[model samples]
Target: MRKDIHDYDLSRHNTFGIHATCRRYIEFSDEADLIGILASLTEADHPLFVVGGGSNILLTADYPGTVLHSAIRGIEPMPYPTSADDILVRVGSGEVWDDFVATAVSHGWYGAENLSFIPGEIGASAVQNIGAYGVEAKDIIYKVEAVEIATGSCITIPAANIGYAYRYSRFKDEWRGRYVVTHVTYRLHRRFTPHTAYGNIAAELQRLGIATPTAAQLRDVIISIRRDKLPDPAVEGNAGSFFMNPIISRAQYESLLATWPVMPHYDVDADRVKIPAGWLIEQCGWKGKSLGKAGVHSRQALVLVNRGGATGADIIHLSDTIRADVRTRFDIDIHPEVNIL
Candidate 1:
């Protein structure tokens, strides 16, 4: 219920350590408080911004309007006439994404096991359809609830309407800045199937010496693998993976395969093939290459890290150079996974 200016430097707040400022910033704790704040806003005068864990973002300049820091936090079972085995968890937008995954796995929830250690929040996950290891967020989402910024009306948008794809959702483009996600409802089953077919998941399970691995084992193994693969934001400062794996036509992939012969790829569609951006980046020799405190991660080529005191402009410049180089060399455009603001 108070509106006052505070030290709003977004450097420490955002995962990238980009020094940027917001004009007005406010944090709220619950749904009612969010609703109350929304009711106070004048529709045309206030341009709204909602920030979650500040993981997958880069701020180029100071905002000229209100920045609403989403803090609606909790996890509760959805009320309904349903079977006991069927569970629906409502998570606050501010809930740490990876922590939520850990909780679900510990509770024997099956859906989020492959998506361990991803950054950002529960609500932002749906908007971006965050994916890793073998799973995507939309795979288990039941529904997403949001408060309309313009009118302060609450809505339960079904998961199908989200238009999920590889690192994308309708929310990223069409519904951008349209809603402040209050909570997300996910249906995780008590007795469920497991996903262990992708990447090193099977190998990790074997290394753990389990014929039949429990959900906890899978979670632990995945966390271990990602810990080794990705640089921690606490030390090096990163926004996880920097680029989306580019999907090209099968003919196009075959052309590259004909040249490289050992080119690895996965089927994205009937004609489209998805290639690892890391492989492409490493081919370009950008991994561990530094330019003015911003560089590709030495350990993982897919991740762009702030080695020290890099500004937003510095990171983007590095990214632009990478993208342009990749496009020129391979004739394949590399798109950034992180959203630039």
Candidate 2:
């Protein structure tokens, strides 16, 4: 572990290129260093925040406390063949998500292929419950190993207990930073089971002339489609998706459906349905809308981008405007998917 602060620039660290200074910055190599650093901070003095890949966060203010960069990296492949056709493999949390998908496809391991090109480390994936196309991280996640910050102890939770949903987790909603994820174990497959059920996935597959696609080919398609749609955080300082697809009750959905026949929605569970926030944003004329450097991406209305040099407050205000507009137009509230600091 090393404690460095003098030359650190947060603009490059965060996906949203906002320039904010941290009071203190520390990097740890393993769990031992993590414990030491946490132990060093006093209750009121230490506002210990975990930063994993810095993809799904917006730095809205100058941090007054310490920032711990999660660098715990190692992938342990545990293969289990549950018959002649099934194969499962577990991955590490600190590993790069896209790299993990690439390796899985190379080895013919097949669960995370659909989530290719998604940014951030594998550790942060569970918190955001990252999903796209016709697949989600929760679908293949078997278990997650994490260390509780309060008691300085480690624990493992099953996929069922993680409270998996469309871009949500117990870690994000209820337990925020109660635990720092150490490793993630996913149960992948061997056979080629292409999940091209999503709206454009099938069309893209047909265009590529691939009837029976391999795991690698699926990763390629997902990466290509995402590159075309979502702006790369490296180039355009922005998180992939700003707001979550709002989930509403069946009654509310039915009412909306009755009013606007073309309103898009997906059944989340038996009682609730998820409505696309993008539809609401596009309806309100937010697509490509600009206010100084802070504006909503032209291609994707759900994504709020930093065009040049925008303040955190500028972005926050834009978000508020979009939220207010969506509510006024659709009578549905929109919640940010990215964590606001």
Candidate 3:
């Protein structure tokens, strides 16, 4: 296996920029290559894990298992079998997620504009159900194709078959180590319908003096918003939005709202309300503060950054401290959106 590299350095692979290595690292260019690697691994009885752009993960320690990565990259326009106003596009797993969004916007395609500037690849996009500005990947994903690692069998699963929720799918849980995503089919609208209701998108659009904006314009606004808030991984060594927003019952939200009148919240449903994790973290006085090499990002309290030379343990310690403080203060549990491995 010429593609298999031993004692592979993964310090540059993950966005957290943590120093870690794997026993073996294999890069597969296509399904045939993936099948070959899977077959070999299956016979060898070696533990394995699949990785994408490495944007949404925190490497806590050197992996003891073989790390399989996809090199499959391409975007193809599929036949639009549905209405005339909708189109289908199949994207390879290794394609950069933001690049695909940019392509869609450039072509005047809707639905992905609000997802602009999100990190990671197309495979993780569908798997993680990555979202921003009120738009989630599940909303646009039509079908997903993956290769079973144990059997080397390829299967195409429709969107309906995939259980999608806030920042999660079966790929993150039950099917986590079982399948390696090969491609994702996205159904996008040909007609533009801007979604600027969430966050400060509407106000930003107004501030920019833009009305009836195009997809590209909307993407630009999103990029600007992200740049203004989130820290760049290249410079800061972080996975954006380290914690998922905590969803509480409406009764719980009401109880907290009585104490803090201005606490921001979003209605998840009649039963639940979503509270910003950043606010909770900031309230705990962890914002822009550091514990050794690990620090809470100043601009976005939700992000945990490596000041420099921060090990995985340092981050975990800092995160634990923040979580404990939030629980003590708000009686809420905020969990990491970034996968800690």
Q: What is the C-alpha RMSD of each candidate to the true structure, in Å?
A: 1.9, 2.1, 1.3
Q: Best-fitting candidate, measured by lDDT?
A: 3
Best candidate according to TM-score: 3
Q: lDDT per residue, candidate 2, 164-190, as tens digits?
A: 887889998788868888788888777
Better of 1 and 3 by lDDT: 3
In model 1, the number of clashes is: 0
Tens-place lDDT digits, model 1, residues 190-213 = 876768887778888888787687
Clashes of each: 0, 0, 0
> Which pairs clash in the backbone of model 2?
none
TM-score per candidate? 0.94, 0.93, 0.98
RMSD of candidate 3 to true structure, Å:
1.3
> Can you list the residue pairs that collide in candidate 1?
none
Model 2 segments more than 4 A misplaced: 1-3, 6-8, 81-88
Off by over 4 Å in 1: 1-7, 42-45, 79-85
Model 1's alpha-carbon lDDT is 0.84
**Error of model 1, residue 63, in angstroms:** 2.0
